[model samples]
Target: MPLDPGTPAEAPTRTAELKVRGLTKSFGRAAPVFAGISFEVPHGASVALVGANGTGKSTLLRCCLGLIPADSGEVELLGQQTGALGQGARRRLRARTGMVAQSHNLVPRLSVLSNVQHGLLGSGAGPRYWSHALAPRRAREAAMAALEEVGMADLALRRADGLSGGQSQRVAIARALVHAPRFLIADEPTASLDPAAGEEVMALFFRLVRSEGVTVVFTSHNISHALGYGDRVLGLAGGRLAIDADAAALSERDLGALYG
Candidate 1:
C-alpha cells in the first residue's frame, strides 16, 4: 500500500512546537516503516497518534525524537532540526522536551522524590553532577512542585517499587514535568493501568496540557482516549498517515475503520 503524505487541512504556522516534512524510516530488505509523513503541532496543542498494532506509530515517534534515525526527511523541534544537530546540540534540544514510556522507568530502589529529581539530569549540568547527584535544595523544591502538580506530593518519600501502577505513572509524569518542558512525548503512558487508573492519568495529563500549555504528542490504542484527550488526532495505517482531523470532528466509528 502506498502511504499518503497528506497533512492537516488547517494547521498552525511554521512557528509550531514540532514540524515534520517527508519523514521516513526503513530497515534493510523491508518495506518502509513510514514514508513521507508530514505534520505540525503548534505550541500548546495536544495531538494523539492512533493506529493498530505494528503500524509504525512507535517508530515514528522515536524518529521524531531522534532516538532512532529516520532514513529521510526532517523533524524540526523547538526550531532545531533533530536529524542534522550534533549530539550536544541535540541534548540541549531534548532538555526542552520530556518523555514518558508505557512502563514506568523509575529506579525501584529510589524514593519517589529521588526518581522525580532524576529528571533534572537533562538540564546540562557539568561532570560534577555525577559526583553529587543527589537533588539539591533547589532541585528538590522543583521536584516537589512537579509532584504537587500530580497530587503525589504526600508520597514523595515512598520507594518507587512500593507504588501501584497508577501511582508510578503519576510519578513518571512528575519526573517529566519537573523540567517544565515546552513539549512532552508519551508512548502509551497509561497502557498498563486499569480503566479507572488510566482515566485518572489521562485527566491529569490533559490538565497539564490545558494549564501548563505544554505541547504534547502521545500514542494511543484506544480511540476514545485519543479523541477525548487530544486537540487533534492523527491515524496511521498501512505505513501512511491515513487520518488527520480535529478530535472533535472525528467519531469512534470514523477511527474504527482505520484500525481495521
Candidate 2:
C-alpha cells in the first residue's frame, strides 16, 4: 500500500535532525528491502519505526545511520549529507550518535562501569577510555552520572554477565547515554525482556532522553510502545513505506493494517 510521506504539520518549521529522501537498499540477487523510502525527523522529536518481522526495520535504521551504504537516494543526518562524507568524516559524524540494540552488547567479563566508559571510545579511542580504572576521573564521573540516570550506578562494579536481563538493559542504556549523544537509534531495545522489565526500561530510557533533549529513532514490534513513546510513527511493509503519520493521530487499529 502507498502512504503519504508527509511529516507532522509543525515538523517542516523545525530543523530536521534526520532526512531521508528516496532512500533505497537491496542485497545481491534479492528484491529491495525498502525502495524510495522518505521521511524527516524534527530535532528533539521521537520517532518509532514499526513493521512486522522481515520488513527491514533494522536494515533501514542501519542505512539511516550510514552503518551500511544505501543502494540509492539520500540520507541526511545532523544536517550533513551522509553520501558526501569521507570515511574519516563519516566516522566523526557517527561519534555524535548513540546506538542501542536488542542484544545488550556488553562485554561479559567487564565491569558495568568499564562497559559504560567504553561509550567514550567513539569520541576517541585510547587505553584510558577502555577500563574503569584506566579512565580519567572526569570520564569515570560522567559514566557514573549516566548510570545514575538509568538507576544502574549501584551496579557499577558488577560484571556484565552477572546482571539479570533488565539490569543488563539498564547498563546498556547507560553506556549509550554516557557520551551524551545528540541522536540515539535503538533497534528492538526491549524485545528480549519480560513485559514488566521492558516497561521500566522504556520509561527510564525515554525520561533520560527527554531530559537531555536527544532526538530518538527506535524500532519496535510492540504497537503500544510505538504509539505511546513516539511523537511520530513510520511503518514499513511490502518493500515500501506503508505508513507515515503522527503517533497521536493513530490508533492500534490504524497500525494493524501494516501487519497484513
Candidate 3:
C-alpha cells in the first residue's frame, strides 16, 4: 500500500510531496510505454523529464496526473496513493496540483481575466456562472497576483485570442500558478516558442520554483535547455527510465547514450 501524509517515522522528512514508484503504462497486452519507472521529487525541487518523441514522456506524465490509468504501479501525491483514487478523490488531489501543457487550452473568446479565473472553478467554491457577473473577488485577486508574477496583468482585460503565442503561454502559466499548487507539471511548455521566448519562459518557471518553494517537474526535448534549467534530469528511453542524474554531472557522451 502507498503511504499517506503523516508523521510516520518511515515517511520522508518532507512527506507532503510527490512520489512515483514502479509506474507502468501500456496500451494493450503489448509492452508497456514505461515499466517499473520510479522516482521521487522532493518539495521545492525542479526536475526535468527529458526524452525523444514517442519515448513515453507524456504518457508517464498523464499516468502520474491520473488522466490515464497506469497498467501497474503506485503513485503518491503529497503521500496519498493516487493510482487507486476515485473520481472525487482524484478531483481533490488535482486541486493541489497544476499542469501547463504545450497547447495553451484557453477559451479564445474569453478575456484573459476570464481564462485565468477558470482556474479557480475546480476549487468548489461555488457554481459556475457567467464571467461578467461572477466577479469572484478573492479569485480575481489571486488571478491578478499570478498574472503579475508572469508580467501579464496588464493584458488581463484583453481577449485571449488576440495575444501572441508567447503571451498566451504566459497566461497559461499564470493560470497554473494562481492556484498555488504544491506541484506544477509542465509538458513541453516551450515547444511552441522561439529560442529567446523559450528561455524567457524557462527563466520565469525557475524563478517561480525558487521564489514560491513549489515542486516543479517539466518535460523538455532540448537537452541543452534542459541541462541549463533543471537541477536534475531524468532521461527516458525505450519506455523506461534509462538515466537519472544531476544535470551538471552528465557528460555529452552520457546524453548521447541516453538519446541514442
Candidate 4:
C-alpha cells in the first residue's frame, strides 16, 4: 500500500543517496562545463553546490537526477546506476525524488492546491488526480497537508500567478514535498526572492526537509545560505570541484576562491 503523503516512508537503506564519478558534460565541440567531478552524499545529508555563474552547478544537479545525461561518467542515485537504468527504471527511480527550481514553475492559471497536487503525477495517477476539482479526497487532503507544512495552506484556493515571490516559492516547496520524496533536489531555490524572503524561505525549507529526514542537494549563490544550510559544501570552478568540505570547517573566505 502507498504511504500517506503526510508520512514520509522509511528511507531506503543506502550508504549514499548520491554518488558521481568522473562526471563530464559539454555542448558540441565546446569545452566541458565540468569534468571528472566526483562526490558522495550520504543519506539524510544536505549538500550545497556553489560556484560562480556558469560553473555547471545546475548541469551537475540535473545529471544527478537523470534529467540530463552526462557525457562520460557514472551517477548512482539511491543505489542504482542512472546510466544503466532503462526508461521504465529511471522513471520509477525519479518517482522517489522531487525537485524545485528558482522559477517556481507553477502553472499560472492553476490554484495553489492543484499545483501541489501535481506532485502526485509521478505516481502515474489518472487525469482525475490532476485537478483539485476532480482529485480524490485523499489527494486533496495530502496536498493541503503539504501546503500547511509550508505555511501556505491558507492560500490554497488562490491562483498561483497571484502570489508574491516568497509565497510562490512556498507553494513550489509544497509541491515538491507533497509526494513525500526521500530525495530532494533544488536549484537556486531562493534566487528569485528578496534577501529577507530568501533567508526565511531557506530556513523553513531546511527545517521541514530535515524533520522529514529527506536527503537534500541544492545549489546557491548566497554564501551565507550555503554555509548555514549545508552539511557539506561543494564549489565548482574551472571545470572542477575546487572545494569539498564539511560546512563547519569552512567559511565565506574558503569559498571566495571559486568566484575568483
Candidate 5:
C-alpha cells in the first residue's frame, strides 16, 4: 500500500505493523547512507538488521523512529506515514513504539521501578507533577508487571546504577515494555552482556513475540544470534541494504560477505 500522510490511529486497519518503501537518507552532500531501502515487518514478527559497524544500521532505525528526517521515501508505522507527520503526531505515534539501546539509557539514581515508570510518561499517565516522589500505585503496579516479564521484578527496588550489566539490560527491556508498545526496536540490545546473558535476553524477546504478539526490529552484529533468533535477517553494507533473506536460509559465507 502507498504510505498515507495522516494519522493511522483512527484507521480501521491493524495498528501493529511497519512498512518502509524507498527509504533514503544521507548526512550531507555525500551519497545517501541508504537508498531505496524497503521492508515490511508484519505484526508479531522478529527481524534482525545486521551489519558491520558504520553501515548505517543505527541511522536507519533512528530515521524510522523519526529521530532523524529521511531525505526521501516513505516510513509507515501501523498505517500512518511517519515522515509526513508533525511533531505532535510523531510523538503520538512514538507512544505506541518501544526502543531499547545498547546504553540502557536509565537514570542511574532512580530505582528500577521508577525508571520503568518513565515509559508511561510518553502516554501522559506518569507522575510528572511530583518528580521526586514515587510513581503512583497504578503506574508502579504496571511497571512491576513489566519488570516481571523481563525477570527483573525482584530487583525493582534496587537503584539502576547498582545492577549488573545483564540485569541493567533486562531493566531496560522492562522499561521499553512498560508502555505496552505495539512495536519494539532494539539496537544492539545485548552488546555489553556475556553469551549466557545475551541468550537469556533474546529468549525473553521471543517469549514476548509469542505471547503478546509484539513486532520487533532489532540490530545485531552477532551472526549466531541473528541466525538463532531472527525470523528474517537484513544485511547492510557500504551504507546500503546488501541482503534481505530468511535467517534460516543464509549460509556463513553470505554473512561473511556482509562483514567483509
Candidate 6:
C-alpha cells in the first residue's frame, strides 16, 4: 500500500535527478495505478521504464514532472517537491524539462528550424511561439545549435511535413533540446518508425545523453533497447515497482516476465 504523504515523515534529501517515494494514484472504482511505488534517477543517468500498457509508466512520468498529482506519497525532481509546489512553480519547472512524446507534434507547415524554435516557448525568456518567425537572432542561433546536435541541421529549412517518420522524430528531439534542459523525458519516441529508423533514433538519443551528460527517463516497448541503452531498468508491474535493478543485471528473459 502507498504511504500517506501527509505523515510527519517527508521524503528524504532530494539528491537524485528524479525520485518518488510511496507514490500512488487511482481513478474512482478502479484499482490503483500506482501503489507505494518508489525509485530514484541519478543526475546524468539514463533510465529506461518498461511495463505493460495501462501499468502507469506514463502516469508516473507525469507525476514526476508535476503535471499531475499523485494521490499519496511524494515526487521529487531536481530538488523540488513537485506536488508541494504551486501551479506557477510547476509550470516553471516543466519549462526547464524537455519532453518528447510519441507523436512528433510538429507544425506540419513549419520548417524544421521553426518547429525546433517551438521548444523555446517553455524557456520563459523567448518571444511567444506564434511570433517565432520574427524571433531574435539569438533564438534562431540556439535552435540551430540544437538541430546540429540531432543531425538535423541540414534539414533546418525543410518543411516538417516533408520529413519521414525518422527525420521528424530527430527533428522532434532537436525541438526538445532547444530548451537546453538538463533533464529529458521521452515516451515511446520510436514507436512509429521502422526498425532501421528506430535504431538510428535510439542510437542518437543515447549518444546525445552520453556526450552532453543529460539525465534521461524514457519508455520503451523493446526490452533489448531498454537493457542496452539504460544504466538502470525499472519494470512497473501490477501497480508496483516490481523490478528495479542495474540494466546489466537484468536479462531480456527477466524483463519479459514483467509483461507476463
Give the alpha-carbon lDDT of every model. 0.88, 0.92, 0.83, 0.94, 0.84, 0.87
TM-score of model 4 vs. true structure: 0.94
Give the Å shift of residue 82 in candidate 5.
0.6
What value does the lDDT take at residue 181 in candidate 3?
85
Looking at model 1, the pairs that clash are none
Which of 1 and 5 is the better model by lDDT? 1
What's the ranking of the predictions by lDDT, best on top?
A: 4, 2, 1, 6, 5, 3
lDDT of 3 by residue, 206-240 (tens): 78757988888899888776788777889999878
- Candidate 1, residues 12-49, lDDT tens digits: the string is 45358899999888999799988989999988889999
Q: Write the per-residue lDDT of candidate 6 for residues 1-260, one digit (tens) a residue.
A: 67687766665653488888999899887889989998889888889999999999899888888877888998888889987798778778888798889899989987888888888888675555534477788888998898899888998888889999999999999888877788899999899999999999999988886788889999999998999998999999888888999999989999999888
Give candidate 6 regions above 4 Å deviation: 1-14, 126-132
Residue pairs in clash, model 6: none
Clash pairs (backbone) in predicted model 5 = none
TM-score of each: 0.91, 0.94, 0.90, 0.94, 0.89, 0.91
lDDT of 5 by residue, 1-260 (tens): 75586845564544448888898998879888888899888787888999888789999999888889998898899779987798888888999999999999888998888888888888866455123255567787888899888888888888889999899988888888888898889999999999998988888867875688888899988888788778889999876678889988997688878887
Worst-scoring 10-residue span by lDDT in model 1: 126-135
Decide which is better by lDDT, 2 or 4: 4
* List of clashing residue pairs for candidate 2: none
Q: List the residue pairs that clash in candidate 4.
A: none
Model 2 score (lDDT): 0.92
Question: After superposition, which runs of candidate 3 have C-alpha atoms over 4 Å from their true positions?
Answer: 1-16, 127-133
Query: Model 5, 140: alpha-carbon shift in Å?
Result: 0.6
